[model samples]
Target chain A: AAGVIQSPRHLIKEKRETATLKCYPIPRHDTVYWYQQGPGQDPQFLISFYEKMQSDKGSIPDRFSAQQFSDYHSELNMSSLELGDSALYFCASSLDKGTGGTDTQYFGPGTRLTVL
Target chain B: AQSVTQLDSHVSVSEGTPVLLRCNYSSSYSPSLFWYVQHPNKGLQLLLKYTSAATLVKGINGFEAEFKKSETSFHLTKPSAHMSDAAEYFCVVTPPGYSSASKIIFGSGTRLSIRP
Candidate 1:
């Protein structure tokens, strides 16, 4: 089975720079969620989209913005990146509940972001 | 508010020994709980989930979790530990309101190390 796909498995950026991470969800999955995991910490929920619409938001920073495209893929764009932003970014996808029952997300290989 | 707590930051067990990872959750409403595993440089894999159907949920790879509402605990357990099971495990919770959107909160990960 095809799993979620993430771009730029590893990224390095300097402070005050900008970066974008992309996620291609599994086929037929209409919900996408983003999470950030700092070293030795838990994965924190950032934001989520359902059927191309922003459905919920968590602790995502103001400098970060995300959206799901018509293709069901999503992107997280960060600006004025700070050293504290360095962490692993993960994307997960699930079929929306309109399809019935509860939604259980499946995650993709995460992108490791390093700020220098 | 919804949150999950992983009681241990790390656990070590010998091969063939029993494995236990403790988790506790707090939610305003009925919650859906999950266990996910992450191997080094790999994506998160869903081990099992509790959606109010059964108290004892059996997952893949002989892993199982029991949802005890009265105790507010959903601990993952396995009969025997394997070297391949050495990885980080996360306890996750999603409140009823956001279940459709698949928004979830994760606990601080517990890194499991297996000895030969």
Candidate 2:
């Protein structure tokens, strides 16, 4: 079974710089979700998209934006990066049933972002 | 509102001893519960999920969880701990009709340590 794939397994950036992360969800999966895990902390929900449409939003910062393309792939763009933004960024894909009876999210390896 | 709480931050067990990771959840409606394991520098893997089907959900690597509605708890357990089982575990809850803004909620996480 093919799992979710993320680009740039590890990234290093300087303050005020910009970065973009990509996520290719599993085949047939229509929902994509983004999360951030800081050092010694649990993963926090950032944002999510269903069928290329923004379905939900969490604690994502204003400097960050994301969009799902027609190919079902998604990208997260961050600008004016800060040192505090350093963390593990994870992408998850799930089959959206519209209802909540079935929404098992499959996660990718994650990208380790280090803002210097 | 839906939230999950992990009872312990860290748990240590012998290689052949039983393993227990406690989790409790609160949801306004019937919620889908899940247990995910994350190894060092790895993505989150689904250990098991409870979608109001079976109270006892079995997962990979000899892991299982029992959902107790009365206690509002879904605790993960294994008969014998393995050295490779050392990882961080998270409890998550997604309420019904979660297609809207309210997404999944994750617990603080519990780090499991296995001793040889």
Candidate 3:
């Protein structure tokens, strides 16, 4: 089966501009998540969608938002990009969030965004 | 609330030697711990995870982690360090149920280096 896939492997945008990144989760997955990774730091949770509802969010700014479609695909949008927004964005998915065992998340290749 | 901390910023080992990456976590309830590996310009990959069921967890690529509730630690280990093992590793912790919102806390990350 094909793993999660992300679009625009690399992106560049000017300060104050808006940028969007897309992700396609694995088939039959019910949960989709977005994460951001800065240089020399671990990946941080941005937001998650499960069953078409916003389940959780991390310490991201209000300018950031996400949407999950009926097909379980997800999109992340960043408004008024800043230099601090330059980082790698990853999309992950899981079958469910059950605590029975390891709800291992499968990730996409990631999208590198540069804000100048 | 939940948080994770990686004890080292970097670790170096000779080829064929054992590899150890230390991690600690804090949680208000029973925690779900995980270890993820990321190569340069790539997305995160699951190494192992520990739920409430077992203390010792084995994962792909010959990696394993032991969860110690008493010490609040979930440290990853490997019998042999391969050159391909050079990458950044992250320790993550999450609360135990749907009410926890599936939110995850990640550590600062530890970069592994292998000597030829």
- In terms of DockQ, the best-performing candidate is 2
Taking all chains together, each candidate's TM-score versus the true structure is 0.94, 0.97, 0.92
Q: Could you give candidate 3's fraction of true interface contacts?
A: 0.56
Per-residue lDDT for A3-105 in model 1, tens only?
A: 9999989999999999999999999988899989888877888999888999888899999999999999999999999999999999999887777735688
lDDT of each: 0.91, 0.92, 0.87
Clashing pairs in 1: none
lDDT of 1 by residue, B12-74 (tens): 999999999999999988898999999987779999999889999999999999999999999
lDDT of 2 by residue, A60-103 (tens): 99999999999999999999999999999999998887633257
Looking at candidate 3 chain B, the ten consecutive residues that score lowest on lDDT are: B96-105
Q: Pick the candidate with the highest lDDT.
A: 2
Off by over 4 Å in 3: A98-102, B99-102
lDDT of 2 at B1: 68
Off by over 4 Å in 2: A99-101
TM-score, chain A, candidate 1: 0.97
TM-score of 3: 0.92
- Across residues A64-115, which tens digit of lDDT does each residue of candidate 3 receive? 9999999889999999999999999999988774533236688999999999
Candidate with more favorable, higher lDDT: 1 or 3: 1
Model 3's CAPRI class is: medium
